[model samples]
Target chain A: MKIRVNGEGVQLKQPIQTVEELLHHLNLEKKSLIIEHNHIILKKDQHRESQVSDGDQFEIVHFVGGG
Target chain B: MLSDNRYHRQMLFEPIGEAGQRSIQESHVLIIGVGALGSSSSEMLVRAGVGKITLMDRDYVEESNLQRQQLFSEEDVKNQTPKVIAAKNRLQAINSHTIIEAKVIDVGVEELDSIAEEVDVIIDATDNFDTRLIINDICQKYRKPWVYGACVASYGVTFTVLPDETPCLQCLMDHIPNDGATCDTVGIISPAVQMVVAHQVTEVIKLLTDNQDALSGKLIAFDLWKNQQMELKVATLKDENCPSCSQAKYPNLEYQAQVKTAVLCGRNTVQIRAGTQKNFHFIQFKEHLKDLNLTNFFSNPYLVSFEIDPFRIVVFKDGRTLIHGTKNPQEAKKLYYRFVG
Candidate 1:
């Protein structure tokens, strides 16, 4: 299966069933990102219940602290 | 009528030609949260000839607000008027052709759908992240474009959230920062607010005049005191799965988030929030404080204050207040009940 991450295409071997599983599989900390799938925002807590399918687009953002 | 040469400068810009001028006159902009950035942005917007503007602010003018909030003056503080009303009056006087409506109330999720759907664009001049998140959610739901602007200490950041195209604030950061640093902890400078809001106002003009292609895809951050500027690229994150833009769901608009206010360091004050109690009285409430040797320092529909012993009990009419001379919330609440009844 293939997923587009932050506009870049990447191939994945494991069939990630949900966004929560994908984040867990990718070792991505949910707290560090604002996750949006197909123009919709998913709360960090809801990632557990939210499922991800083939060709799902994700925008993951991390905040940097500075002046 | 503007002279041919007078209009020539702006008309030559191509985007602000006669056609765009028509759109500018016809467009209605709602600015939620009129504080430092809000007052500056709205003032410039009104002077720039935005046809209709509705300013929503829950705070009143104060000696502190006068430093960075441009529209207010010392006389405004003496009059004890709400910041929104005061800003409106000044803006109307600046350009009578522009219609100014002042709504002295907090912008809640319930009012989001009606208000966001009505305005051509909403500007995020709010101080806190919670309200900014709410504005983003509402704008996303209605597909209304809104420019995000914030300033804390000497640092400022801004971005535009256009639905179905660019990224929303939530698309960039999902959870509200529990440990997010605020101006209260640090100190903010006047020039920082001016520079940040100027960028936001310029972006607002660009968006309103239908020049969306020129919009930048990076989060703009700047520091005047330190003389530093950086534009962190948000373009790559645009493709990341954002719940607000990708899934078509908005959570911040679903409920009233917890409220917590803070004090700006280097400033002699603390912020108190009491949710949505609208009818907090000052004159009658001042009668309760007769026993104390406190003087009525400031009073208005938005705020009231009396000097009590070692501190100032500045009671905002919105039920929120700042008990200057203390940083503890419990102490502030104790003072709130002692004199507010």
Candidate 2:
């Protein structure tokens, strides 16, 4: 299955079912991330239950600490 | 009847005509963190004739700060001037009519609460999320407005929170990203700072001048290096379970365990906070250091710094110490306990 992450296409060998699993698959589960999946901003609580299917588009942004 | 021509060009901008200029002249702004974004926003506000600006910062000037921070100079670095002092000196010269109050102290929830009541708006020039979250709590509690601005490397993000009218920082950012990249690790560009400050100042002016319609309710983020810009419409992003805005509870502000030791971003330095607020007599501390045969030390009314081989520790009158040359919090805590405790 393939999905788009931050405008880049990513090929997933295994089915990444949920947003939590997708983040873990991408090694971003521990990182601070704001996700916009298919043009809707998903709250932190929704990441666990939110499902990601094939051809899904995700926009992820990580906040940086600097002034 | 207005005599000052210094802001004539700014007044001529139509949107900020004489009436708006008068509002700007009568408004007070509190800017926390006199680092990169703080220095730039303060200067812009002062030049545009903001009536009063209270500048707060905990750090002092260093040579590395000259690359991006705009207000300090070589003399400031040579004198080891605190960031707020240097910024006040430069900002006053920019517009002496504008009142610039400089405070060289760490601003916590209590400090912010007292100061927020006196100012029309608060500007986030702080480098850390802890401080920003605290500001969000105080601003929301008091129904005051504040502008949030931050930058690292070539990327920047900004948003304006208008009390109950807009979404707060905690509403958008539920968890502070611990693995976030900092300027100390990635390096920052001057233009990124400029762009972030520009957006922040614009929002501030709009708020102060009563141009509420002109304010952008979205969270703006941009990367100059990548030529990418994003405006997230966060007007509906307010979280009902948000601890700061929704529940009217402020965890960051009410946090009792003050951080004893913190690794400063990019500076390879650790800040060891005093257990309690002590008015450490500078003269007494200096004598104590001298008695210990610590020859390499410098003293001023505000602080005392001594060199200990690879580590240089700067102790403030309030008992906080900044230990340079290490990033490990445990090692910094050990040094603070061994030397200052």
Candidate 3:
């Protein structure tokens, strides 16, 4: 199935059961990305418990150190 | 013999005549960081005729602040008053006609986007660079114009950022210098603050009056003590490569400020921002802490500090408090509620 990330379309590799599984699959760190699934913020602690489906859209943001 | 004569002197300026005065009457401005620049800018905006002004500061007025923060008096210092409250009181007295809303809280990144959109223009008076960058990102995301001003030692800088219409502060400093040489570290001069705030308020007035043509096209820097000025042209820098200006990604909104749980810079103290209650009154709170073996609990007007258990709860008349114990938010919140509550 396909999903949208930050308004861009993307194909899901497999049915990801939870945010933790997706992060492991994408090789993304919680510290590096500010994840918002369907407009609601997910705290790092809750990410492991929250589930993401095949067609779930998410926005991942990260901050770069700049003046 | 006319009633509007109080503002007659300014009305004669043509640019801020009756129509401009009306605009000022209807406009609302949010001032972030009520320190040197925040204090002065809030004072000017209130006295001029801004319909409503929101003054937010995370710190309280200290004895040292009296020299540069013009609105604060010795009485305010004696009271250990919070800067936002003190500034609001003084501004109100100056012009009872305008409404001054004072909030004593850190302008966290998560809150910036909505706050920026609520006000007509955001005025930067904060001393730190991280906060300024957060403000820049939010303003750009909301397409809200904000006036930027800063002063370090004798040097002062001011610029009006109209989001996509001009280059934002990030276009100038891609990465902020995390050095320890801030006003609190090195010290600052009063004249420099005045000059910087004066230029800032002027730009705000120009922007509010729709005199967009007179708006500055470059980043303006000045040395008040040495009598020097530098205007760097940065118009070309406003391009698609800029994340805030071009990509339109608002980082502040995306990321809630890192849980705001940390030990203060001084290992001896840990500062905890209020989690649920955005507002905390130290005066009424001190009574509860009286039971603790507080080294002191002197509270008449501005400041309140007391020692409890393994830490000290030093709360400025403003809502900011320093918990001199573990940097852990859980511990700090427990201590704050036990004593201050």
Candidate 4:
């Protein structure tokens, strides 16, 4: 499956069904992220249930600790 | 005529013509935190002729702050000037006609409520989410508008929250991300700070001049290093179950006994928050400290700090203290009680 992450194209060799799977595949800390799937923000609890399909766009914003 | 001539160029702009300029001159804005984003936004507001501004910050000016924070000088560092005081002096010099109020105290719910009621708009230039959330709660309760801006490294993000009209910060960010990457750790570029403030101040002007249609309702994010920009449409991001806007439950504001002792990200410093808000008289504290054989002691109207071997303790007027040279919250709390109590 291929999808766009932060405006970059990424190819997943294995099938990624949910937002949680994609985050896990990318080795990202789930707690330290604000994920937008298909232009809609997903609550942390919805990460596992939110489905990710081919050609989907994801924006994962990391909060930085500064003024 | 001379007073009006000062803003002649801004008056020429059709959007902010003489009437809009007058509106700008009649507005009041409160800015929290005088760090990078705060300093830049405050400078722009003063130059733009905002009638009055109240600056609230607890930190002092350090040499490291000179790089991105524009409203400070080497003298501020040498004097250990509080950020609000230094910013007020610089902003006043820039526009003496504009009223600048500096408060060197931590802004919790009680302080925010009174200040929010007095100001037309608020700017979130704070470093932490805790303060931002409190701002959101108070702004929502008062039906005031505020601009939220944050920057770290080469990236920055901003959003404007108009009470009762748009989603508050709590509506957009259900959970606060504790990523622990601060400018003190990852480093910040000057341009990133400029870009964030540019957007924030522009929104502020639009709101003040009654140009509500011109305000960007979406969340704006930019990364100068990566050359990426994003406009996340947060118009429909309001959660019905939000504790702030929906349920009208302000946990952040109501939780007053918050004894927050946490290690500042990447600074090797621990902030020992005041268990309760108290008025700390700096002069009295300084006078009492004269008997103690403490070296390198400094006293200002806003705060007082003393060097105790490897540790340096800075006690603010609000009783909150920042303990440098240690990351342990327990150690910071111990020092706070021993020295401050």
Tens digits of per-residue lDDT for model 3, B1-341 = 44467678777898889888888889999999887788788888887888999887766677877777888989877776778888888888888889888876777775565567778888888765667778888888778888778777776677788976887776655345444445655667888888878888988888888778888765666666655665555565565677777788755445454435445432445675554554665556666656554676666555577666677677755455678766577888777667655
* DockQ metric for all predictions: 0.07, 0.51, 0.02, 0.51
Least well predicted 10-residue stretch by lDDT in candidate 1 chain A: A58-67
Error of 2 at B23 (Å): 0.7
lDDT of 1 by residue, B1-341 (tens): 55344345666777778877667778999998888888888888876778899888866777877777889999888787788988988888878888888887666786566777779999888876767878887887888988888777776778888888776787677555544445556657888888878888878888888887778766776666756565655555563566666777786767463554565333455666655555666556656555565576654545667787778877765566667787676676677667663
Better model by TM-score: candidate 3 vs candidate 4: 4
| lDDT for each residue of candidate 2 in B39-112, tens digit (9 for 90 to 100) | 99999999889999999999889899999899999998877899999999999988888998999988787678
Please give, for residues B162-235, the per-residue lDDT of candidate 4 as tens digits. Answer: 87778888877756777566788788998998998999999999998889999998788889998778777766
Which of 2 and 4 is ahead in TM-score? 4
Q: Considering every candidate listed, which one attains the maximal TM-score?
A: 4
Sort order, TM-score high to low: 4, 2, 3, 1
The alpha-carbon lDDT assigned to residue B56 of candidate 2 equals 93
Name the candidate that leads on DockQ.
2
Q: Given candidate 1, what's the lDDT at residue A37?
A: 77
User: What TM-score did chain B of candidate 2 earn?
Assistant: 0.95
TM-score of chain B of each: 0.83, 0.95, 0.86, 0.95
Q: Candidate 2: where is the Cα deviation over 4 Å?
A: A1-18, A21-27, A48-57, B1-4, B257-259, B291-295, B328-334, B337-339
Give me the displacement of residue B135 in model 1, in angstroms.
Answer: 1.2
